[model samples]
Target chain A: QQPVQSPQAVILREGEDAVINCSSSKALYSVHWYRQKHGEAPVFLMILLKGGEQKGHDKISASFNEKKQQSSLYLTASQLSYSGTYFCIEGGSNYKLTFGKGTLLTVNP
Target chain B: EPEVTQTPSHQVTQMGQEVILRCVPISNHLYFYWYRQILGQKVEFLVSFYNNEISEKSEIFDDQFSVERPDGSNFTLKIRSTKLEDSAMYFCASNLDREPRAFFGQGTRLTVV
Candidate 1:
């Protein structure tokens, strides 16, 4: 089953902060985050493997909680480049991924 | 940085015609996958191929759809008979190893009329 993402859409200003949450009904082995720009392919942001582990690069970061089967993506000091749809996919056995409903984020300058 | 490359960035096909989308995943990546996205819709999983064989496929990847790793670097998705609903953006992705992180190609915009 696909994971569920909160706040279907978000509007933010440059230099603002935003958080997109993803919740899964089943246990999650790995959570992969991607961002898709208009008419482009989804770009890989990061992947979190285990619970309680936090990973970040630049102003973007994410946390995974296996116990809750949830993950959250944090975009700090947002940039115009951050305007896109975010998808949190749950990776299951055999490397298969189930995609979540994306959270559309628009960052205006 | 090595990236996945897809051919024919945009393809237009008539219904009932066969269409093939080609991709070259990053060399040395151990896994390959195909995904589809309709206009304004969430991406959907199509299939995954590993070790020169299909490791998994989603319900969306039915009899009409087939995948092939014809050579060492080329991965292809073929729709035997196209339909209007099959029109979408097709993306090819690759993973280095056990890590679930994937690198996606620019994508092929398929337009079936």
Candidate 2:
């Protein structure tokens, strides 16, 4: 099944912060976060392989709650360049990924 | 940095015609996959190939869809009879051995009319 992402869309000003959440109905082996700009392919951000493990890039970080079948992406001190759509893909034994509909983030100056 | 590359960034075709989207996965990767995303929709998995054979495929990937590693450095997805609904961006991905982290290609935008 596809993972569910919350706050389908968000708008933030420079230096602001935002969070995107993803939850699945089944257990999660790993959660992946990706960002895509308008007319561009998705770019891998980070992956959380186990519960309580956090990964980050620049000001973007994410946490995985395996027990809850959830993961969250945190964007801190957002920049205009951070404007894009973010998707979360849940992976497990099947190795098949079902991506979330995505969260549209608009960062304005 | 090694990256997956796809050709003909955009393609336009008519219904019932055949369309081939090509991709060159990152060198040294052992697994290849194909995914599609309709405009304003979530990306969907189509299939995965490893060891020159399909490992898994989604229901959306019926008999009409086929994947091939025709030669070194090239992987392709061919739709035997394209439908208008097939219009979407197709992404090719690959991952190293035992790694679940997939690197996606820029994608080929197929527009079937």
Candidate 3:
């Protein structure tokens, strides 16, 4: 099943911070975060395994909580390049991914 | 950096016609997948291929849809008889393994008229 993402859309000024959350009903082996710009492919941001580890990329970071079957993505000091749609994909036991509806993040100058 | 490449950035075909979308994943990546996004919709997984066969497939992948690794370097998705609903951006992706990040192609905009 597809996960649920909170805050369907968010607007931020450059250097602002935002958080997007994803929650799933089923247990996830891993959670993958991706950013997609208009008319472009989704780019891999980071992957968080089930061990409750947190991973970061530049000003973006994510935490996965296995017990609650949830993951949160943090964007700090956002940049103009950060404007895009963020998708959280849950990996099942079979390794197939089910993506969320996506959160649209717009970072203004 | 290695990236997955897809062919025919845009394709337009009449309903009921067959269409094939091709992709070349990063070399040495063992796991391949096909996903699609209807205009303005979220990405949906279609199938995953490994070891020269489909490892898992979603309901979206039915009798009319099939995938093949025709050659060592190419992965393809074939729709035997397309429908209007099949019109979407088809993305091909691949990863090194089960837990690694999957890289996606720019996607082929399939317009079924």
Q: What share of the true interface contacts does each candidate keep?
A: 0.71, 0.68, 0.74
TM-score of 1: 0.96
Candidate 2, residue A37: the lDDT equals: 87
Models ranked on TM-score = 2, 1, 3
DockQ of each: 0.76, 0.73, 0.75
Cα displacement (angstroms), candidate 3, residue A104, comes to 0.7
lDDT of 1: 0.92
The true-versus-predicted C-alpha distance at residue B13 of model 1, in Å, is 0.8
Per-model TM-score versus the true fold:
0.96, 0.96, 0.95
RMSD of each: 1.2, 1.2, 1.4
Tens digits of per-residue lDDT for model 2 on B1-113? Answer: 78999988999999999999999999899899999999988899999998999999999999999999999789999998999999999999998888888989999999998
What class would a CAPRI assessor give candidate 2's docking? medium
Q: List the residue pairs that clash in candidate 2.
A: none
Positional deviation of residue A89's Cα in model 2 after best superposition, in angstroms: 0.9
Clashing residue pair totals per candidate (backbone < 3 A): 0, 0, 0
lDDT of 1 by residue, B1-113 (tens): 78899999999999999999999999999899999999999999899999999999989999999999998999999998899999999999888787677888999999999
Pairs in clash, predicted candidate 1: none
lDDT of 2 by residue, A1-109 (tens): 8889999999999999999999988878888899998777899998888888888978999998848498999999999999999999887554566789999999999
